[model samples]
Target: MGIDDITKKAQEFLGDDKVKDALKSEQAEGVSDKLLDGVADAANKVTGGKFADQIDGARDAADKSVGNE
Candidate 1:
């Protein structure tokens, strides 16, 4: 799928509540990096690196949407 598709799917899977929780838990001093790394890794595994760029974009979008950016 495309970037938009990936982004929408990620947002749906994460949901507002989980995204908020992640943002809250990760917005702290040093946890965001680790959280984002985990997100990227999960995305990579899910997509098997076929849509790496889209996955990265979706992760960033999710982060920005939840105020982690």
Candidate 2:
């Protein structure tokens, strides 16, 4: 799938509350947050914000993956 499609699917899976809760645990939440932010920042820098929407989608994917949002 394309990046946007991949991100959409990933976000759906990350919507599970149990998974979300587990991801937000004190032990892992900090790392996950930092990782997502770093990845988003890197993408934005690399594309000069041309793909800001895609980067945001990826961020949503990460957030859902870690059950953060």
Candidate 3:
């Protein structure tokens, strides 16, 4: 399959209720937040903190997508 095909499949899987529920559980325990924080920190370091705000916003959006506030 192509990159688009893999992306589409991933989107479909993430859209499933079961998958969402699992993500929610992970978020509840702070797992996703920690992971996102690490990612954002790395991204900020890569760009010398120039895009920190945008990276943080993306991190928050990703966290919310998992089903939490």
lDDT values for all models: 0.71, 0.80, 0.84
Off by over 4 Å in 2: 1-24, 67-69
Best candidate (score: lDDT): 3
Of candidates 3 and 1, the better by lDDT: 3
Displacement of residue 68 (Cα, Å) in model 2 is 4.9
TM-score of 3: 0.76
- The residue ranges of model 1 lying beyond 4 angstroms of the native Cα positions read 1-29, 66-69
TM-score of each candidate?
Answer: 0.44, 0.58, 0.76
Model 1 pairs in collision: none
Instruction: Report lDDT (Cα) of residue 68, candidate 2.
Output: 39
For candidate 2, report its TM-score.
Answer: 0.58
Candidate 1: tens digits of C-alpha lDDT, residues 1-69: 899999999888777776657655645424655577698998899889998898788777656644334
Better of 2 and 3 by lDDT: 3
**Lowest-sum lDDT 10-residue window in model 2:** 60-69
Per-residue alpha-carbon lDDT of model 2 for 1-69, expressed as tens digits? Answer: 799999998898779877667777875767877888898999899999999998999897767756334
**lDDT for position 58 in model 3:** 98
lDDT of 3 by residue, 1-69 (tens): 999999999999989988878877845538777788899999999999999889999998888866455
